[model samples]
Target: MCSNYDACTKPERLRMYFGVEPPPRIKSQVWPLYEAPFIRRHPHKDVGDDAVPAREAVAGLFGLIPHWAGEMTFGRRTYNARSETVAEKPSFRDAWRNGLHCIVPVECIYEPDWRGGKAMPTRIQRKDGKPIGIAGLWTSNTKATGDEVFSFTMLTVNADDHALFKHFHKPGDEKRMVVILREDQYDEWLDAPASRSMDFMRQFPAELLMATAEPDRGKKTR
Candidate 1:
């Protein structure tokens, strides 16, 4: 479950990698409710009478708020959706079934490691030190003033047996972590049918990940 992360990639870099228009400059770091870039499927009009689906990088809130939710506060608890129950959860079921998928790009993710029987802030990144894509679900909510709010929630999977991820959570709590998608699989994730999407929710390779501890910070929620 990734609640905060580094989004230090320059807008030009994102445009080159995702092939979408450059997004506005983002902060060096992002927390819940912060606006950041996420890639989603969009329609592209060609010369003829044909429209093709293309990936586009757009800015959106980190937490999702279904249109049906009455208050924005609900988003505070929806920064992450469990992979196993996403299809059944009320807040995410509609978006999941509607194929509202997106990819969260980040330089690294922050988590808490309890290996020392005390929470320690840790930053997890790709061993190659490149930006990674986190699988997520997105939706649009209309405010009473008619303004539309676009947001997303990262998908997470149990990591009880994962060598690196399993050490993040508390000793007695179930271990969980976000599903990091490989670069090659990003397109498929955005267009795949909901019925087959679950197949992609697998644990990230621990060997490909590197974790470094920072000074302990106050507890953060996922």
Candidate 2:
């Protein structure tokens, strides 16, 4: 589903529009497409963070694949992981099992809808400028050529009243929203007992989210 939302061509322009400099992750890949804001703002960024290396020079494709998967054209670009069932998904099970640490940086993410036979898009973001730390699962994949591909999946939970019901309502379904973590809560999320990660992730506060539909300025590139 996230495939429909093209990466922001000039994600760095977010700084000019948002009036703040992006984090290292954001500064590095602000062109071609928009990535998660918190990822752009990650504080512990390095080639190998806690024994895990960056999958790509920058962010990898949004869809996540498990290390055991066989070669395929698309391999199913599953961008979002269901909070309720992440522990059971074939793709996300091991990463979570191995205690992989991941950060999904994002500024505003776009979603489209049709009303009165016309299309409209919503730009969702925090009212505050702080990047939303979307908790995720990451893994390392080795291609036939031997290039390592590091990938991640954003965990999803029911939307908050402010984000899901307030601004994200669509015709058929708006039941899902990406999980956003607070700075103080990041450690708990990253270090939570596997038994509790899903529970802790499902209850993201609603007040932190703020959004409105905009005539897509189409976030720009470097």
Candidate 3:
């Protein structure tokens, strides 16, 4: 599960890679509950069904807030939804059944490597050094104060058989990875129906990914 990641906040990269404009402000590094940009199909009403632009970028919390959530804190544990149970999980089913698909533009995702008997932070990114679009679901919630809040959750798939991702997490725990969609599949993912959404929940090729150890220097006490 991806609990930490860097958001792609560069306006030029957001436009050239995701084909959407950047939000006014977004955190460079995002954790659960942090606001970040996500791309989804523009509402038909806004485009009159004949507009040229098909996608739009909107800022939303990194964690998904289910409609039934009594408080925003509920999102902390929902930042990553298992693809296998997303369609049935109470926290994610509504967004899945409604096809509220979205693409999370990420600079890189942080994972733990425990090969050396200790957890080492690893930064994974495309081999070509380009931003990646991760598959996710987005939802809108109304607070008691009558304010609307948008949130999203990244979709993850089993990675036991994946060459690279199979090494993440712990030595014995089942490995998992986020679904990184190909550039050509971004539109298809956003437009696919709920039934067909599963077809895009597969793992990205290992060869296209590169990982390097990036231990947290801030953790060292003076």
> How close is every model to the real structure, measured as TM-score?
0.90, 0.67, 0.94
> Deviation in angstroms for 97 in model 2?
2.4
Per residue, candidate 3 scores C-alpha lDDT tens digits across 117-149 of 888989999999899999999999886225788
Per-residue C-alpha lDDT of model 1 across residues 118-210, encoded as one tens digit per residue: 878899999986788899999988862267878889999999999999888778889899999988898899888888789889999999999
- lDDT score for candidate 2 against the true structure: 0.54
Each model's total of backbone clashes: 1, 16, 0
Error of 2 at 112 (Å): 2.4
Candidate 3 colliding pairs: none
For model 3, what is the error of residue 104's alpha carbon versus the real structure, in angstroms, after optimal superposition? 0.1
Which is the leading candidate under TM-score?
3
Query: Model-by-model lDDT, in order?
Result: 0.82, 0.54, 0.91
5-112, model 2: which lDDT tens digit per residue? 322224454333322333334332322223333232233535456544222224554556567765523335556777777778787787776767565656656655
Q: What is the C-alpha RMSD of each candidate to the true structure, in Å?
A: 2.9, 6.4, 2.6
Order the candidate numbers by TM-score, best to worst: 3, 1, 2
Cα error of candidate 1 at position 111, Å: 0.5
